[model samples]
Target: MIESTAPLLSVRDLTVAFDTQNGTRQVLHGISFDVMAGETVAIVGESGSGKSTAATSIIKLLAGTGRITGGSITLDGEELTHLSEREMERVRGRAIGYVPQDPMSNLNPVWSIGFQVEEAVRANGLAQGRAAVRARAIEVLQQAGLADAAKRLRQFPHQFSGGMRQRALIGIGLAADPRLLIADEPTSALDVTVQRVILDHMASLTRDRGTSMLLITHDLGLAAERAERLIVMQNGSIVESGPSKEILQNPQHPYTKRLVAAAPSVASQRIQAVVEDRGVETLEDLAAIPPTVRVAGLTKDYRIRQGGFRSEMFRAVDDVSFEIPRGKTLALVGESGSGKSTVAKMVLKLEDPTSGTIEIDGMDVSGFSRAQSFGLRRRMQPVFQDPYGSLDPLRNLENTIAEPLEIHGVGDRASRRERVRELLDQVSLPQDLATRYPSELSGGQRQRVAIARALALKPDIVVLDEAVSALDVLVQAQILKLLADLQTELGLTYLFITHDLAVVRVSSDLVCVMERGRIVEQGTVDETFANPKQEYTSRLLEAIPGASIPLGGL
Candidate 1:
């Protein structure tokens, strides 16, 4: 359905700037690109690289003092740069659709899902009556991969899971059947399997409707696999632009090379680079090490209240057992709602297992008294997924890290202050950042602070629950390298829980694949990835966004 001759969308010499307290500051400079009818284009870069700024500029949705300083934006040869607010409103949903990055922030919590989609349909004049709008809403939701859309139309955003909410947003974006769809990091936070379903649905729907797509993301693997042409952006400039395969195989820019090397999906093939960089022992050499934490017959269940006086027992974790060898890593891999986090909570003693035995260095913790539990806390700690949520916004970096040591009564105020600086150094954070609050730091820096806080007590066992899942590829690589180096230097153990299989390959010695409430497969990382025994495990590997595309291959 694509027309190879003419461009559906075109932008030339686009320059954007913002009026800051320090005066005018330009963010994007001389950016130009074209998207042919039904073709997909992707803009890739790290945070603050002006990728999202460009996308937002196309829709004239920039916040605050942002304005287009210079450039021309045209759609179907219609100039849009100088359009009035009122005129742009008519062109928004009717000619161009936008799927924002975060569904929780974009979707209204007070409204039902059906109302939102219906509103878009009515606003674009795609449907005449309320009944027609409702019918169209259901159709779009179903096309977006939400099963039983009609039955769940009345549900609020909070009632749906993260994946379901994302699908709902996609449904609303496509409700008007716009000519162009701009998806901004649509699958960044989703599990690989859920991401695959959403992406596949978008591909089929867009192709069927002849909708040209412009994807904005930091993930090079995803962009390489999905986009027909790739635009590599750095410091608000286009360093490289070419066919995705050609750019991957022969990157002309230094930034592009760094991006490819840092990406986890492709880096799995060059994992030895990580080991060499950290000088850590291979998994085979670490096999004889005794486990720092051991679990046997772990099970967790919850009672869900049904109708009056009735409840149903739900098994959140069923007979889940794994071991983290001293100075080694054990990764739990699964999709969302697969009991990986439940198992982590049980191990960290944050949740009580219905029936199981947890032994930390041969000390049974199932029957620990209050005093004994407090003692256990000093030896094991947790680093959660959302650093923003985990860190205390009111507390500065020093106090956040020092709080743990103070809780355990480890040292005096003076000694604790020195320890905070040392912990910052250990996590590769600048010492000057100790006085900055969480809000002042970037996402990667906040996560480093969280890691420093977890290590304040010198815990032998650290449980990282999706710790690197939210990070950019380069930041994730740095964090993983730091973890590996710390493991080698301090001999610490890690219980790594994540839905990202690409990460498990390079960072973990052992892999456990969980599904429903049980582990469907467990083995060494090499064995499991090389020959997955379970169908679910194989499916998960296949679901990785760019799994089929070889690194640096045409």
Candidate 2:
């Protein structure tokens, strides 16, 4: 189905470098590829492997120290590499569209979705009249698989869910109908179901529109399914490229082979082993303690606005009930829109439930006073998804981690510093890193800092919302091990909200499967994973991508 005439985008002997004090460090070394019209070409590589650098270089968005030192880039026979800033700006949105990696960071939080999309449309000279622009925005939002697009456009970024934000970003990308679309990890932040839906929408849209696509992702399976050609990059070099199926099945390069093998599927890795080491506390340990937190008949309903003041009550968490014991982990697993995070937010008192009895340590926390809530907060801490975003960008590591101690008046200056140091050691961060800001640290290091910050208060329970999902496999394993070690040392409890079943199997004593605001299944990790009773649970288990491959091979 690929149209292989004159290429839509072409790059020859591309080279990019960053000027560090040590010298010019080559990031992308002599890479060349052609993307034809209506064809999808995927670029796959590990983190820091120059995959994103390549994309950024193409758009001339590379950092101050980085530049494309050599190579020619052409789109529709017009050279793009040597364009002026103003000229490039004119060509960017009109000739080449872009969907960034994280929609949340890319979008304006204060603006309504409509204004953002409309601005994109106006910038590209797509529509003249305001009404026409709004109409086009709604149409594009619907094309991106968002329901009630016109009504949803009025909602702010925070009001919309993470997946919805991704859809909004995609809608903005398609507003101008650019000749080529450059999507950089568009679905990485989304849950599996939402990811599938978005990918299907993108594939369908580009095919129908005859728009060429350049997909940059770490997910090989996604590339295999969507792209016509595959270009593998590693250590700032192009290692291989050819037909997608051929490369996937018979990769010539070791890196490509590893990438292909890492594609997780249902038949790949079996859910057999415990996440924790043997001789650790099991289900019996949970049975020993009375419930630490209990929710019975939990429900939340939002008044959704339709047309001209018309409203309808939408239930997000519908009669969900569960219990968590002290010194154990209770994992809530589901794809996006499955209401797992809604339950966590309610538990954290970020959102008030419409109806439910939520008891913490045999007492109801649903209606706690300010003082009582402060006490509850001291008992329940949170570790969010993005460590870099959560931590203070302006504050140094010591202040950021020790701020909790200062807030609660736990210890004086000397004692707090000592505690901060101890916590840093506990999380395996170097002592020297205490002076650095969050921006200076790598993704994994930032996450470690977040973990240290979460543990600073010595909270009895920690709500980890997709805490380790963003990390690489090796770093993820380290963090998982650290969590287990912490549980043993501190006897801490965790409310782990994640879509990763592997994390559930390894870290949780109990697993709760959520679907559309309801608890579809709940049991011991072994029982539920090994013998999932409900069809939804079975499907979740089945949806564990590339599970059949051996970990060593991957």
In angstroms, give how far residue 97 of model 2 lies from its true place. 2.8
Write the residue-wise lDDT of candidate 2 on 127-222 in tens digits.
889899888788879988899998998989998888889888888887677889999999877766667678878888888888999999877666
Best by TM-score: 1
> Please, what are the lDDT tens digits per residue for candidate 1 over residues 272-300?
32345544345565557777888989999
How high is the CA lDDT of each candidate model? 0.88, 0.83
Residue pairs with clashing backbones, model 1: none
TM-score of each: 0.96, 0.81
Candidate whose lDDT is highest: 1
Worst 10 residues of 1 by lDDT: 266-275
The reply for model 2, stretches above 4 Å from the true place, is: 1-8, 18-26, 63-65, 76-78, 84-95, 105-139, 146-161, 175-179, 232-235, 239-292, 300-315, 335-338, 349-379, 472-474, 501-506, 538-552
Q: How many clashing pairs in candidate 2?
A: 12
